[model samples]
Target: MKDQQDIVDNPPPGGSTGDPFTISNSLNAAQTVTVWIAKGTRWSDRDQVKAIKVVYADGTARVHGNQTGTSHSFKFDSDERVTSMGIWTGDRVDRIKWETNQNRTFDHGGWGGTEHSEELGNGILLGFSGSADSHELISLGASFREDSD
Candidate 1:
């Protein structure tokens, strides 16, 4: 097993102040990561999570997200990395959480922005961003766990 430790906790922006918010993070190795968005943030009639983009070890990427849900979670293979994520039609996430390399999970609040990011080891960067008309970046403060083999 690998010794997992705190990678990064890129705090969110002050508040949801504009449209097309974005956040990002970097990774040191291929890790199994779960991405989440706070509840009450995604509404069918308003801004909802649009997509999540994951870059694999080979440099390819995949986009995924739920249009109707309080949160969305996905797993990245051991050799893959979650490059970026975002939501639409809504602003402010009650919480943002992620666990990498099956180690301790890291979380943060005030995670609202058109574009946000953090630098990680091995020259990796991760964050999230999105654009919408009826939205303002806001903080998030809830959490959920996701496990995979």
Candidate 2:
């Protein structure tokens, strides 16, 4: 019999556009996440999240969104896993922060929107899903596997 997985999804906030995308790792946990932030003169059209890439424990990886900014990487220890995430968004994603079980944290991007955070107690981050345009990431969300215990 196939293993049953309990997946929890957090939908993106309103005012998001462009092609829909989902990047996931059904079998392996996430090991690293890289985010690209574009620093532009204008806050409305630029200075936002450009793209994201997640590398799984299995050495497999996936990248989404646009590629037009400086890249920042968040690497996790072998025994560590993501516990929660915080996002700031408006018409586009403005900032992102990730906290791990080890209490390590990584924050990036400009602060220019409403803040949304989620604490996934004991849950393992599997992937991310949302919408993005050719210029930046319009919206962002997350998917995780709930702890069975």
Candidate 3:
């Protein structure tokens, strides 16, 4: 078992910051990890929490937020918005989805290039695994596995 400090300098391969929940180690097939967290900070204000999540790095992922309540006997919470989101990695997006938030169709958005497109995935939908602003350079298809079936 690894600790939060371990994954800091030497993060696992293909890791990312989209991970709202921190992972302590690599997950094996059919394996589940329960983040005990022991004690930590949720915000800069140092708000504490029983925040927990199930990290499964096999086929898909499940991200949920804990509302933290009582009389519920306390249990693992689930968030569908970001649940089982597909990961896209490549030169071009496997799919160019909502660059913004609206609700329309593919290759189409509002009047000002604003995307109200389909919610194919989560986050920006096209946040690009990379950290830049080079959408025009991205072509129709990325040879990366994230695009190819």
> For candidate 1, lDDT tens digit of each residue in 1-149?
32224334334433445354333323333223233333334443333233334443555453334333333445455444333322212244433444445353444323333433433343233333333233323432111111211
Candidate maximizing TM-score:
2
RMSD of each: 12.5, 2.4, 15.4
Alpha-carbon deviation at 61 in model 1, angstroms: 25
Candidate 2 segments whose C-alpha is farther than 4 A from its true place = 1-5, 40-46, 119-121
Q: What is the TM-score of each candidate against the true structure?
A: 0.31, 0.86, 0.17
Clashes of 3: 3
Compute the lDDT for candidate 1.
0.35
Model 2: how far is 76 from its true place, Å? 1.7
Model 3 misplaced stretches (Cα beyond 4 Å)? 1-80, 96-129, 137-149
The lDDT for every candidate, in the order shown, is 0.35, 0.76, 0.22
Each prediction's total of clashing residue pairs, residues at least 3 apart in sequence or on different chains, is: 36, 0, 3
lDDT of candidate 2 over 2-62, digit per residue (tens): 1335666778752457788888877456778899998632365546788889998788999
Compare the candidates by lDDT and give the number of the best one: 2
